[model samples]
Target: MKTIASCVQEIIISSPFLEEGLSREIINFSALAKDLNKPISNMLRKPVKNGAIMMALRRYQQPLNLENSNRLKTTFKALGDITVRSNLSDFTFQNSKTLIRSHSQILEKISANSQIFYAFTRGILESNIIISSSEKESITNAFKNETLIGSKDKLSAISIYLPNGNSEIAGLYYQIFKRLAWENITLYEVVSTTNEFTIVVEDDLVDKAFSVIKRLKD
Candidate 1:
């Protein structure tokens, strides 16, 4: 008979988290065994151990670090006070520091959602502009070509918004993303504008990823 521990191990290795590599930093079987007060060796011996292993693999697949720790606090501070109900947008393919312009409608829609994560000073707009729903549709449709570079298993995307007179700021943002990549946090998508940059990640990693960017502003 297959030992229960062994079975559990088999299941974990089979899961997508291990296969996809989106969050390898957060998941570790041996660490989990220690946490649960079980010996790593014994946990490896159970039948259907594969399932447990996979569960453990996914448990921390979302990157959680000092950045997210602060983001949660800041997000709460900036947008948390609003009464609108909004789900955190799944910007799994967005990068930061690029100017983002929305069509009339998207801005309105975004304004309604309370989970809005960032604060930008719109210097020129006489009034505080919000993302109306129509504007959201126009912007998403406006950007036709999406460019992503890196390995398929680990990819990063950066949105480019090269406008007159803003090259220096763009370079700074690029450098920041590059440094994070050096730390092995692969980026998925980058959305940009002459003055804005939006970074995206797997949904599970959003909070932790947000934390990472928050540090740069501090």
Candidate 2:
């Protein structure tokens, strides 16, 4: 059965900013309890006192924050190389039966050039391709018949080398994305592997983006 504390915890986890604010002790507990009163009551199928919600929040935030903070600290300290590749292009295509075939063509064309940067991600509705600007023509030719949803030139990508076992770290991605969003940076495209995190942004803003991520290590 749902209780006040469980409901409050559910609310907190769903809203990441709330978790962060509460973690930092910057959020107003009484005010938060009042705001959450209706939701917790609805979840428990009954009325919940504001003071009871506040007490649950107080009970949960510290240990939760401490655990996450310790993991984050270790992860950042173990962060590997941060490589930035400039002058890239991003292409978004509406997915089609031919999409995978077209992507293969581009890969075959550029496979010989180890210096060229390329990354492709196929989503359910769309397929995104990011490549070195000089290599954009190859993709354009390869995907000529595909439906192009959007494309951006003069983009740059930051490929962050993550430490081992990052996939097991809770809230790891949230913290990285939170820092970038806090800086008001626009992420044009993002792709990742098990231990490699990549973010593509406009060419001009790359330096600022790099600075922001680099500081995460310090």
Candidate 3:
């Protein structure tokens, strides 16, 4: 049989925002108990009273605080280095495979001269590429069969390098993203490798984003 405490922990882990409400004492226990009874009953194979559910929620709140603190420590430690690049342009291409074959030389030229940011979606319906603004002319000439959806210039790229061992830590990216989201900065796109995370945004927001991320290191 599943214990009340275990069931409560499962619920909090699954719905992380619930812990926030519980800890703030903003959640109405009666409604929460009623809503959770069905799932908890399903898990335990027996019905539970509302009072038992409320008690379980209260018991698990302290543990959730400790867990969040440990997660923040791990995430901060994983962030090794941060950098920003500006004056970039983003291009979206349709029918990318055809474009690749038709303009191999031009593509190579752009690749050699610029920091290329490229992603191809499954089924090859669309491909998005970004490069330095100086390579715009070469990229334009390269498209024979591919449709140029649009291009955006004056963009900035923020590169976050993670520690070697902790690069793969869970929630590391989320912590960075959450900080950006909190500041209401719109992201153009995000690209990542095993040890590096990059977010592209408009050039104007670069300083604000950099400051926000710098605080994470403090």
Model 2: per-residue Cα lDDT over 13-92, one tens digit each: 88867877887789899999999999888888888899999899888853357776788899998899999998888899
Indicate the worst ten consecutive residues by lDDT in candidate 1.
Answer: 79-88
lDDT to native, each model: 0.40, 0.87, 0.74
Report the lDDT tens digits of candidate 1 across residue range 100-125. Answer: 43323345555666644422233342
Clash pairs, model 2 backbone: none
- How many pairs collide in each candidate, listed in order? 69, 0, 0
Residue lDDT tens for model 3, 68-179: 5676676676577788888888887776456666456665565654356443322357667767777677677776457877779999888888667555455667667766
The list of candidate 2 runs beyond 4 A from truth reads 62-72, 95-101, 108-115, 123-126, 168-171, 181-186, 203-208
Error of 2 at 36 (Å): 1.7
Best by TM-score: 2
> How are the candidates ranked when ordered by lDDT, highest leading?
2, 3, 1
Q: What C-alpha lDDT does candidate 2 achieve relative to the native structure?
A: 0.87
Candidate 1: segments with Cα more than 4 A from true spot: 1-165
